[model samples]
Target: MSESALQSVIHTGDGRTLTRSEFLSLINTYNWFLKDQAQLHLTYSQQDRDGEVTVEGFLNISWGVTMPIRLQIQDDKQTPPSPLITPEISIPVSPLESKRGMTRWGEYSDLHQIDENAETPDIIISNVPPAPIPYETTTLRPMRHKNTEQEAESNLVRCQSDASLVKMRRKAKTAAQREEERQHRFSINGHFYNYKTSIFTPTHGASTKVRITSRMSTHQVIEQLLHKFKIENDPEEFALYCVHQSGEKRKLCNRDQPLWERILQGPSEDIMKVFLMDREEEEVSNDVAQYLNLELPILEQVLLKLREEESKEIQRVISKYHHQHRLLSNVLNCKVSPHIETSV
Candidate 1:
């Protein structure tokens, strides 16, 4: 908060009021005189201006513009306050004289130079004075302690830190638990198709595609599996063979539908056994071809390549066979299948 600045107003010598423009002109003149550092200036007396309120108080103030000083306007209706003191009109003074503490009066104490720094004297405290011994023995003072409120607050901080550590441990444990749960769902034979075809809800609208799955829907697939396994028999004989192999009772064998379904679902030991058996058969066939000193056909080579998982080269050969029809397809009779097929 600062002192309020009041505008210096003058009364016209006439009894009538002057217009606002006239009032502005007089104030401008007053401001210019102050800037010029004039020694004498006109006093804001009552008789100076017409219809203006008598000059009462004279204020020398400092303030910011945005936070302007609020003052009451004195119209012709009311008289203003009396002047307490006149302004000390600015006067020219030499720079040397000003430095030597010269004011309008005379030499004064050089108070302005108090802030100027001077070299400090060195200080040394060699030894501290001993604590005064009490004439009378006093009860041992309870060991000096921190304020109870402050001590309790520090304890609160420790408790909070402990809680934060516990929370972090719990969070880490929860993350580990989630990871374990995720890994548990994983199968060694797991691949993208299983995830894509699994029973999961879509994030959006009604699903267009539906998978109609059955445990043992078609006899053809069973026949194919048996053919791949070299079991040349009807479904009944196959079931019997499977029962004997599994060591299950005849009645228990009826669950072959589910057994086939689970086998097809993969990650199954039975499927792995079939694959391994096929590999062994292929190896035996290769050995027989070598012993006979007979070269394997191009299609057989392609099938072998495919079974060994050289899919990209197999596709390249297939495309080449299609382009050069007589050299490949006609000569070898290569049967085409869609992507993901292991056999020709």
Candidate 2:
């Protein structure tokens, strides 16, 4: 038969007709499926009957089950031939044959007995003589003498004294450095201010020039200013604003923030103007007040334009009402007047 005809034969188990390539492909797929479970070698051949095919193989399955498989495919014109796969009678496997190199249960003890029975040769040993001591090497004193003990004690005392001297020098140096740094002062706007001392001048307008440290918060600075100036305003009524060179002001929203953070938030200039404002009175800094004063003329111009637009809108509405009343009166006069007919 042709190669195509042979492949067209139906395969059983899965119920599908397959070409020669498909049949081989199916066998390859099963090869992978049974790879772990069995060892199979498949061979195909044409049977004596016409239109009959046979596939024979040997399968050695798991758990020592070995059998011969014979698959028969008979062609039936009415329907596709169904392949019949039959396995030969399985032969009983002998246990001894299967466990050729495997050790039995009692083999370990047998090995132990063989090892014990093997004899070891006898060994001879002679006695060793004692070594004689030289007369010149002998010493009258013991290994640890009084002089050596005294030397060790003196060395320990010297080490302890050196350690104490080093510790005292380190402490003195640290204290001197701390005192020098504490005495250092920073200059703001040509005025030198020391953090350790309160340098402030009180004024009547609830204004003051106070020295603020990195550790002081806005609230603490305000409190210090209030206490020094003797301003009786409530603590909550006061706020801090950083004035810019452009005359714009930014309110310090977080009063609990440290003065250092507030300074960082200001412009990059070394010295910046900061204002303490009374929220109730809305008292802004002099710079901010001047900036608002400059904007007064522009604000007045905007108000004037808005009023002119309002007057024009009112006049347009009044004119529209008068025109509508005139049209209605003309229509009433035409209907009420009588028409007089002259001679034709």
Candidate 3:
């Protein structure tokens, strides 16, 4: 397989590169053999590159009854658009043969085939018992009675049980055990649905992270969100809403219903988001523009009143300045006041 200089690099759909350890962990988790894995193996060789690679190979893993697999790699002058190409693997060239064959009776599977000819007579045996047929026991010798002082024993080649082993009935699980099983889905246990969730708050104009389960109800989700945001108000005062990409909003009203199920019934998360806001404030905030318009007349009246008061104050200030201006103009014209004639 031809590898580029950056063949070791692992790229994600989100345009992030993972470390080698992380990449190998993911590849192991996926059960797909990486090209690097082949290169790292002591038995790996360029000559063996003609074969298809299976995750089970050399690792002694087997999925089902199928032929052996050899790892193969392909090269390109330009880099592939996919990150998986580096592993350099392809499907099996030959079709797997794990299907049912022609029908046959399994009970007499080891018996020879019966003759199907006109010369052969069809014998019908009724209530008359047939002669006893002897068959060898699957043992070197027959076992003696165990009651003797030194009992002679003959162990069978294959241990045979007289009857099928009685299966033990499983104990019923308690309510707490069932609850624990529902809540925890560790990666190793395999149903990995743990999502890194962010709870957005329209009221606070911010967001906070809170771990919640898909089985949680709308009321429970709202309560958790309120606690995460440190909101002192009652949880009932707040409501959880899903906002669509087209600016459509849907409120989750059923307090007992599963919150995640309701969200999935609508649009996908990428096309919508969960937001927390006050129930009453959400309705009022929608009509805030109209409410402001209603207050415009009162605001205009207050402005007019203020303007009338400002005009009166301006008239008083202008009268005071006008007397000072007249006196200054007479002094500039060199006209003496008649009251100061005697002093001159």
Candidate 4:
């Protein structure tokens, strides 16, 4: 074995470099000493951080029992396009045999054997039958016993019964406790759905109206809004609608006229504008007014109030995303802008 260095030519792209055939020759020389016929698998990993490259070795799987093996190569000098070099190999041995075969270099002892004629150990047998003893007999002592020096003690029937009842109650309570903690993933229309909190800045003609769903803290709502804005460029289509306190009809409209115009220039926006504009034009202005309140302050007030209930809702939704879906939590963490594709 070579001394562990901050680097080896294998990673540093230095030292006596071997061609693919020469490197395999070195591996073959060392591998010839291996006595076991097990089909050993090897894994290799290489990393380059802060300048130098590092190579790591680990067990891929047991010999003979095959598995999908993975390898990572990091050196620019040795990879294809350049003359490829075979990597150096080191055989591993168990700690127990390491000392015996110790050499100035290192030890490579025969550990696991895959002999075809290896004898199997015989199984041991026992004659005893298992017994199920009562809880009182095994754990609790009887109050009375048939002994010469003592008369039979009074019955502990009540005490034993009370203990049994207590145990039963505890068991029942524990079961109920688990049931209480069991989380029910909320669902609607027979499908599991997460609570999506969004801020809508709708545009009605020249007016901009803001509406928020899922009242949460202002910071949390703004953060979520920022995230939405990054992913959804056209905020107007999300539609700001007013559901009046008096149970009036809901009205929806764009809140950012300039943004709405930009959106309408796009093909999808043209379709939406053509459809929704004609539809809204046919309705009475008051009917539109009742549902789509273009009042700016009211919309702003609604956004301001959203945070009052938003903290709990964000917590609930984020927890679900963390434990259930594992979607937004990472995005939330690192404060990764939503526009970045994490997988890429």
Best by TM-score: 2
- Clashes per candidate (backbone, < 3 Å): 12, 3, 5, 16
Distance from true location, Cα of 54 in model 2, Å: 94
Backbone clash pairs for candidate 2 read: 7-18, 7-19, 7-20
Sorting all predicted structures by TM-score, with the top scorer first, yields 2, 3, 4, 1
| 1 versus 3: better TM-score goes to | 3
The Cα error of candidate 3 at residue 292, in Å, is 20
Task: List all candidate RMSDs to the true structure.
Answer: 44.7, 39.4, 26.2, 34.4
**Ten-residue region with minimum lDDT total, candidate 4:** 57-66
Candidate 2, residue 298: lDDT: 82
Candidate 1 lDDT, 5-37, residue by residue in tens: 134433233232344445545545554545554
Best by lDDT: 2
lDDT values, one for every candidate: 0.34, 0.47, 0.41, 0.32
Q: What is the TM-score of each candidate against the true structure?
A: 0.14, 0.24, 0.23, 0.15
Tens digits of lDDT, candidate 2, 1-344? 57766556643322334466666565555455446644343345655666434454431101100111111121121332333433343345545333233333433322222332222333344697767953442287545434887786777534443324444445334433465455433222233333332343323223234544433456776766555333445656666666555555555554344343332333232234566655443435765455465567886776698799999989999999999999999999999999999997
Mark the regions of model 3 whose C-alpha exceeds 4 Å error after superposition. 1-205, 256-270, 281-344
Cα lDDT for residue 202, candidate 1 = 22
Residue 306 deviation, candidate 2, in Å? 6.2
In angstroms, give how far residue 178 of model 1 lies from its true place. Answer: 4.8
Write down the worst ten-residue block by lDDT for model 1. Answer: 60-69
